[model samples]
Target: MERMDGVPPEGEGLKGGTHRRTDGQVGQWRGVFSPGGGLQPLLPPPGPPQPLPYFVRRSRLHNLPVYPRLRKSNRRLTELRHVEGDIWALERELRAFLGGRGGKEPEVQVNEVTGSLRFKGRWEGELREWLLQRGF
Candidate 1:
């Protein structure tokens, strides 16, 4: 590329690449810019996988829930990956708790159109209130 002075910009350096004739080893990399341009590492290298929460070592109830149960009344709880305890898991846990063994427990059907989770049957606002209190 021609410079404003009509000379190829930075030709005194690499012919078009960064390296020293003394050694083929990589020289100072150019444009080590970060997301907002700082002298920090251009990109963070892959880090070790994060360890699971110590809560996992506690009782089963302390572990994360399968997903955040959004009730018909509208509420937001901890992420689906971090929910535990409270009445959020009740609907799905009931059949197992009662040993219904009818080969089917209540299922929560997610509405594809409205993005809502509905129970196989209503709990007379019980489930909705419980989830709301816990921000589910």
Candidate 2:
């Protein structure tokens, strides 16, 4: 019998065709297999998984008083009231912290005039914990 390519179906004259390894291993191949019939060492095992920054010790929020209040209306929002310093700066820091924690950064609407920040989510618990850690 012949295949569409006109080659014998018995794999005659074929070179380097797929065949079982002499090692009797099954399934897909992994790592480098040398011509010496010995499996070379695989790449060094990956390093330990990294922990999120949130899990680490919390640093104090110096000179920045954060009072997070949860306000629920048509939407859930975390309101940072009585902020003694720049609200925009707080927003930037919060964004960086949340992003570092390996989660999507939540949207923050800053009311410069009111000196308050509206974070779009029910992050009351997280905010409270973050603030408490900062010695709020």
Candidate 3:
């Protein structure tokens, strides 16, 4: 082979790492021997961005009594929903049957012996006398 600086070229360097020709020619390996082409530097792959999480609050049944007006207002406000094939409409229609609206206060019924106060309101199938017995 040929002498590159002080080191002697291996007899068959093309089979190894040395840049040399097989025919004892003095050319550096390259320019032709590589079938697929030249070496390329390794690279990293690209990826998607991280996403954020979503959250929500939960509710429980104990809070219903805290808003008395809201609790009572549900039926009055949505009177139509309470009506329909059901008997709620009948209850509303018969509300006037409860008594006269003479005073601002809701009608009160007091037991003669027990003296307990009771509020009365109409129901779907119950008789009219139950209101005088119960209170509103």
Candidate 4:
């Protein structure tokens, strides 16, 4: 690279590479010059992952339904992982409350595309209790 004598022309750096313009445009070489005139790499070093917000962390700890990504990946229609106690015990409870099945059976109609469930009739017994507890 040629040594520059004075202020370089726009987009022209001392290293013969182009710098990004203040108007948000990049020049031909796709490199920026440092204060000492060496080319500075475009990307910065990677850092650690950021912590979840306080509410999100609290929700996860309390076994509450938080963001979809924080929940189990293969959750079924009647399967909720947030209840207290062992997972198997909770699964048994949910299965019993949902009337012995995973998918919406006779009473509830589920839209396959949107995953929305509609109860054709009134919900009763443990099902009603569970839904109410979960604020549904």
Candidate 5:
């Protein structure tokens, strides 16, 4: 087990040792040469690149007083700051309750001199369950 000139001397035709040189002759010794000698196939060096699992959606706005704040410089927007009263009539009743909940109608952006409302995408748990069923 000490012959390494061109490999292939283990069990005559060494099958499982993987030194691979099954005796067909002509410049045998299969993989692991490379310094510009060519052969290379041993693998296992690639690593890094796997981040996509997001999930997060569980805040039905409890004990509400109208909080709603997720705008980190626009992560698709969802603000609602301070907002005392009549912010454009709560943005026209939140666009008529999201246009009667059927689809398309989610861009409400009435600032009214900084009263704030901005909701474009992630409507904070359906706008805090429509302002806690209009009792906010």
Candidate 6:
């Protein structure tokens, strides 16, 4: 039988490969070369940064607030969120007024879901006007 050398043949295993041993213990490959057998770059060099879109650039330059969800909503971005908040405040005020905290006595119960005030009494002159002005 013929004898072969310990060195691997070309293209058969790691190219330019070398190993170290400590106390006859052969250490694994710790070099940075790619194991794929090629010297190609791991990643292509990054390209120049892209420019922002017109609206995005403008908003950023002006420090404008962005409302992403408002575009899909029924309201415009220019509209404030205070409409519902105003309604809620009016409901609280009406509840207080109905509970005799507003120096007026009226038989009325504010609906929770619809926020409508139902008058159980026939005295509807002043209370009706107040509720109507508050959009209830």
Which has the greatest TM-score? 2
Instruction: Give the 10-residue window scoring lowest on summed lDDT in candidate 1.
Output: 52-61
Residues 3-101, model 6: lDDT tens digits: 132233434422333444546654443112335553322232256433321111112222222122234445222211112223445445545665663
TM-score, candidate number 2 = 0.44
Global lDDT scores for all candidate models: 0.36, 0.53, 0.28, 0.39, 0.54, 0.35
Residue-level lDDT of model 1, residues 58-91, one tens digit each, is 1133322333445557753322222223323443
4-93, model 5: which lDDT tens digit per residue? 345434333221123324574434344343445434444322564223221112223223433445557745767765565556766776
What TM-score would every model get versus the actual structure?
A: 0.22, 0.44, 0.15, 0.22, 0.20, 0.23
Model 2, span 18-127: residue lDDT tens: 33445764323223334454434334225653333222121232223334454656666777665645566667877787667677999988876766677877666676
Clashes of 3: 5
Ranking by lDDT: 5, 2, 4, 1, 6, 3
Ten residues in a row with the worst lDDT in model 3? 61-70
**Alpha carbon RMSD to native, model 5:** 21.8
Question: Which number leads on lDDT?
Answer: 5
**Local distance difference test, candidate 3:** 0.28
Candidates in order: C-alpha RMSD to true structure: 16.8, 20.0, 35.5, 18.6, 21.8, 26.9
What TM-score would candidate 1 get against the native? Answer: 0.22
Model 4 earns a TM-score of: 0.22
In candidate 6, how many Å is residue 19 off? 94
Model 1 stretches astray by more than 4 angstroms: 1-104
TM-score of 3: 0.15
